[model samples]
Target: MEPRDTATRYDQIARWWQSQHQNSSYGIAQLKRAIQFTAQRYLALDVGCGSSGRFINVLLQHGFEAEGLDISREMIQLAKEQHPGTTFYTEDICCWIPPKSYSLISAWDSTFHLPLNQQEPVTKKLCNALEPGGVLIFTCGGGSINGEISGSFQGQDFDYSTLGVDAFLQILTEQHCTCRHLEYDQYPENHVYIIAQKCDRSTSTTPN
Candidate 1:
């Protein structure tokens, strides 16, 4: 699907997104791990942040300055209501420019919305927005490219055309980001969790 079309589709489902994952234990665990792994009191940005502000709240609770951005205005509004003190903007992840480098960038379950062709550029932009030692934590839908899978949520059929773990790792490596940690085991129903650190440009030959 086109990027705008994907944004519209998500906007239409924003109200129901939180409810769909209200009882997800795995989701909870993933968020907790992301927050714990951040381990920085510096500012953080949550890209493609949906309606649920659980991760944002966790960051704030741990004394990190947190903000979020999403393509869906409806999701942004819901996030604003849940986190009035924090900032939330309606912005496309592909082209959004953050005002300052963040200590951490979190993209939980949201990167799956990007078409495979757009992932590399977006990942590169995200790397540019990270501070010297910043970390990027994200999850991608897990499946072989040729696999067929479908699920229903909010009266719409959700399909998976995911990149295999190896292919996904190649994208990161090509972007000049090293994968410090990765886990993708629960196949057919799994998502890849990745933690990549931004290498210091001054100390290294490349700009991360």
Candidate 2:
């Protein structure tokens, strides 16, 4: 099935997703890494934010004024109710353009669901959306090369795809982002995450 199809499926299960993820720790590691790498907390964007405001809440705790974007209208609606003060948009990250740059961006386990063909372009766009010295945290399949796969979520099948490490590095490099950290967050699982920072004109690399 096409990756875009997940939007409809997610819309149908928005509440179920919110219930499951409300108290989850699956993305805590990535969020912590982002918080560490982000020096400024002016603004943050959460892509594919699902129906839970958990990450948005964390960003607020870190002093960031946060916003979110998701493809599912149902998900956005649920998130808006949970986070009335935080802005949330219903748009596909594959084609959505940021109105302004962000100090920090988190895709968590979201971007991997984009079509394989759209992965690289979207990655590059997201990297470009970063303000100078901005931090971007995202996840991808921990495979050695570019590929796609199918997975079942709550009995419904969905597609997951990635441009892999090589393409990711290339996009980061082209966008002048320093790869700060990368790891298979769930070691036994294929869940890989990365923390990268857009280079400030004065600094060639992120601080160690």
Candidate 3:
């Protein structure tokens, strides 16, 4: 499901995704955990924020000023409409440069969509984008190796890839983040999530 037109595919479903999100609690639950783990309620970034602005809203409610980025222009448009005063970017996370360091960064269900090859590097960039003691929370398609999986959503094909559990932990550790929580609690579905905290540079370990 590595469609040549990823952005367009999501654009086609932007409204549908937004409408359906109202009844979903998945994002909210993850955000609650992210907030609990975050040391500061300063600035937060929601990578791959879809039209719903669910994560962004949660950040705001908990005292963080939030901004978002999504690969789909239509999704960004819808998010802007839903959250008039918030900033939302339409750029692929794999190539985008984070504008500022954040105390909280939540990729949630988004980063798994990046190709397997981009996982480590992009993740490292994300870790570097965090301020000391900042928290990073994201989900991955649980597995032991690198690979891709395809699925159809609302009749459109989409792809998900991962660098596996071990690789993910290694990358985070190399970026000087401590793995605080890694849960496959949503087992049987290949869904795994992790909450990691950036260590203060003074006490950080240099990756060999």
Task: Return the top candidate by TM-score.
Answer: 2
Q: Identify the runs in model 3 with alpha carbons over 4 angstroms from their true place.
A: 1-4, 201-208
Ranking by TM-score: 2, 3, 1
Query: Per-residue CA lDDT of candidate 2, range 34-151, in tens?
Result: 7898767899999999998889989888899999999989999999999998888889887798898999999988899988899988999899999998999999998879998998
Q: Per-residue CA lDDT of candidate 1, range 1-208, in tens?
A: 5557667777788878766643345455655565565535599888877887877876677678999998888888887887898988788887777788888888887777676667667777887787876788887766555243456666665544456667767767766667778777355557677788776566677458
* Each prediction's whole-model lDDT (CA): 0.73, 0.88, 0.87
Please say which candidate is ahead in lDDT: 1 or 2: 2
Looking at model 3, residue 79 earns an lDDT score of 93
Error of 3 at 174 (Å): 0.3
What ordering of candidates by lDDT runs from best to worst? 2, 3, 1
Task: Find the 10 residues in a row with the least total lDDT in model 2.
Answer: 199-208
